[model samples]
Target: MSLVGSNPTLSATVRWLRVHWGTGSQVKNRTIKWLLGLAWVTAGLYFADKGATYYRQGRTLPPSVINTIPEMPPHRAGDRVLVFAPHPDDEALGCAGVIQQAVQAGAQVWVVYMTSGDGFRLAVERQFRQSHPSPELHIQFGKMRQQEARRAMRLLGLADWRILFLGYPDRGLYPLWSSNWTPSNALRSYYTDTDTNPYRDTLHPGVTYCGQNVLRDVEQVLRRTVPTHVYVTHPADDHPDHAATALFVMSALARLRMQGIGFAQRVVLRHYMVHCGDWPQPQGLHEDEPLTPPPAFFNIGLHWVKLNLTPPQQVRKMNAIKAHTSQMLMMSRFLQSFVRQNELFIEQPVVLPIEASLGVVWEEPDEEDILRNLQAPGDFSAAELRMENGQAVFHINTRSKPRPGFSYSCTVHALLPNGDVTTTLLRTKPGRQSADARVDEDGVTFRLPALPSGSVLVLQAQSRFAGLAVDKTIGHVVRLP
Candidate 1:
C-alpha cells in the first residue's frame, strides 16, 4: 500500500496494462513498465514537495523539532505541581509519573491540553466520505476519544474528574496560531455528537467553546483548584500548540498574582517537554548520552516524584494514550501504547528578585498623585514615581563615594511606542556601596552620554562584576533616578 495520501498512478496503470497486455504483454511490457516507473518518480516528488511546503509554511515541525525530548527541573514533592500536555497522550508521555507522585504526596496536580486535535478527522473522513465520513461519523470519533480518556484515567488510577479537554481541533491548531486558520471553525462548529454550532451559542449553550473558555476556564480552575502550584508543557516545544498552552498558563498565573487572590510560597514553575523536541531526543541529546543535561529551560532539576504504577494505573495511562486512535495509526511508532514505570519533570525556579519586579512600586511616586489618591497618609516612600525624559532626567543624583579601580556603565533598554527599541548607554565612575548613581535638576552626569525617551526601560548596570548562571544573575533590571 502507498505510505500516505492518494492512490499511486502506476498501480492504477499497472493493473490496466496487465489485463490488456495479456497477448502483447512481452512486446510492450517493458515500455509500460518504464512509463509506470516515471509516474512513480513524479508522484514521489509530489509528496516530497507537499512535506516541504507543510514544514516551510510552519504547518508542521521541522525534523529537528519533531525528534526533540523534553526535561523537567527538580523540586520537592509537597510543592505545588502543574502539567501542560500538548495533546492527550502527551501527559502520559511527559508527566504521568509526576501526577502519580504528586497525588501520593498530597501535592495538587493540574493538566491542561492545549488543543483538541481533531485534524485527523478530515483524513479519516476521506477514507469513505460518501459512506462513512459523515457529520455523525466524526462525532462518534469524538465519543470514542472521550471513552478512551476515561479508560486511560482508570488505568493510570487517576481520579476521573481531574482531566479536562479544551476541545481544540487536533492538527489544525498550529495553522490557526501561525497561519490563517480560525479557532471558531473547529471550536464553535466542529462535527461533534450534534450538528455544527457556534462556540458561544452551542447546542448545549452550557458547553463552552474551547478557545474562548480556555483562558477563563483556566482562571476559574485556578481559583477553584486553588493549586499551590501550576504545571504546563514546555514553552520551546516545537509544537505550536504545546508552546501556546504553556504561555497561556503563564499568563493566567500572572493575572491571578495581580488580583492578589492566591497565596505565594514560591510557586515554582518549569516546563515539561512534549511534542516536537518534547520527545525523540534531539541530535546532540542522543549523541551525548543522557541529552546535554537538557537546556537550562528544560533543566529544572533531575529530582522527581516516582509513582508506583499499579496494574490498573499502568493500564489507565496506556489506555489514555491509546484513546487517541487517529494519531496512533499515523504515528504509531512515536505514539504511546504502554505505560512506563516512571514519569519525569523539571523544576527550574525562575527566581525574580523582589526589587526586579517591584522596581516600579519602589519608585518615588509624584507627591501630587500619591497625595491626591491617598485618603490616609503613611510614609509614602514606597509609592513615589518621578517621570522625566532622557538618561539624566529620572536618575537620582549620586552622592559620590568614588570607588578604587572600578568603572560603572548602564545600558537602558527603552521600549518605544512604535515597537522599536532605542538603547542608550550611560556610564559613570564606580561609586562606593553607600553611593549609588544619582540625578538632579542639572541632569545627573553619569560618566556617559544622555539616554533617549521611551515608555519603559530595562536598565543593566555593569563593570564586569557579574553575570547570570546557576550562581549569580540576580537583580538584572534596576529603576533609574
Candidate 2:
C-alpha cells in the first residue's frame, strides 16, 4: 500500500538510498538524513530573510541621493518667506535650517502654525501624569506648545512677532477639508471640546472651526505678508493633518489667484515632508547623513531640492528642535532625525488656472500603499473634470471594482468672480448612489451644477471604508472657460 511501490521514481530513490547507506547502518543513515533536512530548512530561512532586507533597501533612497537634487536658492535681503506648519514642532523639524539661513540672509521670515498640537493624548498624559486629562488641561497643553514654538523659532533667529498660530483643531483638519466645511456645522476639537478657535492671540480669535475660515485666515496672511517664498507640508504626507494643511493652503492660493491677486502668481512654493514611512533612515541623530526624499515619491513628478547646512547651522537646528520640549519628551529620536547635513524639499510649481479640460492621475507607489495589509476596497487611479453638454462633469477612475462597505465622494468648491463661494458634493455609499453620481464597474462619475465663467473650482476625490479615508487625491484647481 506504500506509495513508493506505485511510484517508480520514489521506489528507485529508496533502493538507491539503501544501497548507498547499507541496510546494516540504517540508524546512521537516518541521522544523516535528519541533519540534511535541517540544514536545508535553515538555509532557506536565511536566504528569505536576506531577500526581505534587500527588498526593503530597494524601497529606501540612500542618503547620497541628495547630491543629485538641485540646491534650494539662497534667500537674500528683501526676500519675504512664509513657513506653514501643521503643528508647533513641525516647523522646527522640517524648516529650522531654512529659517536660520533665511534669517541670516536678512530675509523676513514668518511661521504660521495651523494647529496647537493639543490633540495628542500621549503627550498630554505624559506632561500631566494623568491617564485622563480634562479639556482644560488640553487647552493648557496647547498654550505650552505655543510657547515652545516661540522659543524654538527664537533659537532659529526668528523674532516673536513673526510667529503666528491659527489655533485650529490638531486632528480635525481633514474633517474641515472634507465634511464640516461650513460654519454652521463646525467641527469640535475632541481634546479642547470647542467648536471654534479659542486662543486670543490668533489672527482671527473665535473663528469657527470650518474650512472656509481656515482658508480665509490663510488668505489674509498671504495678503498681509505677501511672502516671496512659501514653504508648507507636502500633500502626500502620511499624516491626515499634514495633508489637509497642504490642501487648505493650496486652496487659499487658488482663491487668491481667482481674485486677481498678482502676488499669488509671483510667489514661490516649496513642500517639505515630515511624515513618511520610516524615512531618514537609521533614525535618531545622524547629522552627517543628508536628508533624502522617500523612494515612494521618486516618480511622482516632484522636483526635489536640497539646502546644505553649515556645521553651525546644523547645531542651531538641533537646539531649535530641542526647544520643542513637549514633543521631544515623546519623540526625541524622531525629531532629531531631521538634524541632518542638508534639508530636503520639493519645488512646487506655481498654481495656474486650468481652462477647458483638466485631468489628474494618482498612481500609488508600492511602498506608500496605506492598505497594504487589508484588502483595498478601491483606490483612485485617475480623475477628470470637463464641461460636457453645458454641464460640469467630474469623473473618477479606480484600480478595481469597489467592494461593498466602501464609499466614494467628490467635492468641488467654486469661487465666483464676485468673491462668492459655492460648494457641491456627490457621494456614493455601499449599494446606494447619490442623485448626482453614477457608479459603475470602473469608477464613479458626478454631474455638477453649471459654474459661471471665471469661477475657480477646487476639486477633491476621496474613498473610504468604515468611515476611514483609505485613498484620496490632492486638491485640483480648475477654471471655467
Candidate 3:
C-alpha cells in the first residue's frame, strides 16, 4: 500500500531527480536547453516590445530606418522613367510599391540593376572550409543571386525588356568609390588572385567599378533613358555600395544638368535608403535637423507632383516585396508591413521657381575670418569662385597658419532677399574652427541661419589680414550658396 502511494508522475520524478542529483552532464544538458530556449524567446519578445513601443509612440508606421514609400502607379501620368537598383534587392527594398504605382498609373518604368549583389553572403562561403572547399563556389553563388533577382522582378510584374544587369561584381565598392586611384595605404592594394577563397570568381584583376567609371557609365544611362524623373539611393545610407551607387547617380545628374540637360524638363532626382540601423532619427531634431547627407545633397523639387496610391496598387507593391525570397528571409517583417503608407520627399523648399535673385555672393580664401553676403572685397574670379544656392564654402587648403596679436571676430550673417542681414546667429568665435565646422577636400561647411523661406539668400566670406600678406594669402572672396 505504501509503495502504491509513491507512484512516479513525470513532474514529481523530474523534480525529485533535480533535487537529489542536481548536477551532471545529462542534467546540465537539460538545464542548458531550457536556458537557451528562454534566451531566444526573450530576444524575440524584446523586438516585439520595441515594435509595440514604437506603435504606442505614434512612430510605428514611420520608417524604422531611412527608406521611402513605394512609388504609386502613374496616377498622374508622365513620360518614361528608369529606376536604378544598386543591388539585387534594392529595387524591391527601396521602392517596389512606388514602381507598381508608377506602372499602374501609366508610366513606362524601366529597371536597371547596377550589380549582381553576390558579396553579402559572407557566411555561406565559410562553410566551404568545413565541407567541400572549392573557390568556384563564389561565382556559383553570385550567379544564383542574379537569378534570384530576376525572379523577384518578374514577380513584381516586370517584363524581361525592363531590366539591365551591369554584372560589375559588388564586393569592394566602398574602396573604389572613395578612391581616385591615387594609391595610398587605404586605396592601394595588390589583387594577384582570389584562387584561395570562395569569393574567387567575384574578384577581378582590375578596378572595374571605380567611381569615375561608375559615374561615366551611369551618365550614359541617363542620356539613353531620358527619364523625366530619376530615383537613386540615398547618399546618407550606411551601406557603402548603396551610397556609392547614389553618388554615381548624383554625379551623373549634376554633370548632365551642368552640360545644359536641365534638372526639370529632362529629369528630377530623388533618393531612397535601405540600410536600417544608421537611418536618421529626424524626430529627435526639434528644429534645424542634423543632415546625414554625405558629401552634399542634390535637390530637384522646385516644382509640383501630386499622386495618390490606391489600395490595390499598394497591395501589388506589398506582393512585389514578398517576392524577394532571400531578402524577405533576412529582413524584419514589421518593416515590410509599413511599405505602403507614405512616400516622403524633401519639399525642396530650397529650390523654388523664383530662384533668380539679387543676392550677395562672397568668397574668401583662408579660414581665419568668416564673412557676410556682400562680396565686400577679395581675390579669385567670380566664375572661378563657386557658389551653391547663395553661399560660398571656404577651403582652408594650405596648412593652416597661426595668427598672433590679432583679435578676430567670427560672424555668420543671415542674408534675407529683402536685404536684411542679421549677424545674431553666431554662437561663438571660440577660435575653434576645427571643432565647430566640418572641413575637408570638398570644403568647410557649418550651419548658417535659415534663409527666410522663398527668398534668394547669399553666404559671404571675409577675413581681416593683420598687416601681413605673404605669411597668409590675403584678400580672398569665395561665394557658395
Best by lDDT: 2
TM-score of each: 0.48, 0.83, 0.51
lDDT of each: 0.43, 0.80, 0.44
Per-residue lDDT tens digits for candidate 2, residues 142-183, read: 899999999999999888999999989988887898788899
User: How far is 194's C-alpha from truth in model 1 (Å)?
Assistant: 11
Superposition error at 12 for model 2 (Å) = 69
Tell me which of candidates 2 and 3 scores higher on lDDT.
2
Question: Model 3 TM-score?
Answer: 0.51
Provide the global lDDT of candidate 3 against the true structure: 0.44
Positional deviation of residue 154's Cα in model 1 after best superposition, in angstroms: 1.5
Question: Per-prediction count of colliding residue pairs?
Answer: 47, 0, 20
Kindly list the per-residue Cα lDDT of model 1 for residues 1-481, writing each as its tens digit.
Answer: 0013223354576687677676665748776788789889889867865654443333222334212444343345556555656556677666565666566666656665544443344445643454335555554554455455545555555665666665554443333322222234334333343322212311123433343345455566666666666666654454556655664455455445534554423456656655432233332111112212223222222333222345554555555666656656666555542244334444433322223223332322111221222211111122112433333222322223223343444444443334433445555433332132442232232332343332333332333222210010111122233
Q: What is the lDDT of residue 73 in candidate 3?
A: 33
Candidate 3 on 1-481: residue-level lDDT in tens?
0001111254475586578566677877877787689789889868865664454334222333223222333434766667887777677756676677666667777777666554444322342342332334544645666666667677667786677766444544445554431223223211111312223222232334444455556777777778876776654454656655765565455445435565433466556656533233332211122222111122221121223345564565556656655455554353363354344332121121222343322222221212211212222222112234644323332223323322122233233444333332221112446433443322233444345553222222223334212221211111223
TM-score pick, better of 2 and 3: 2
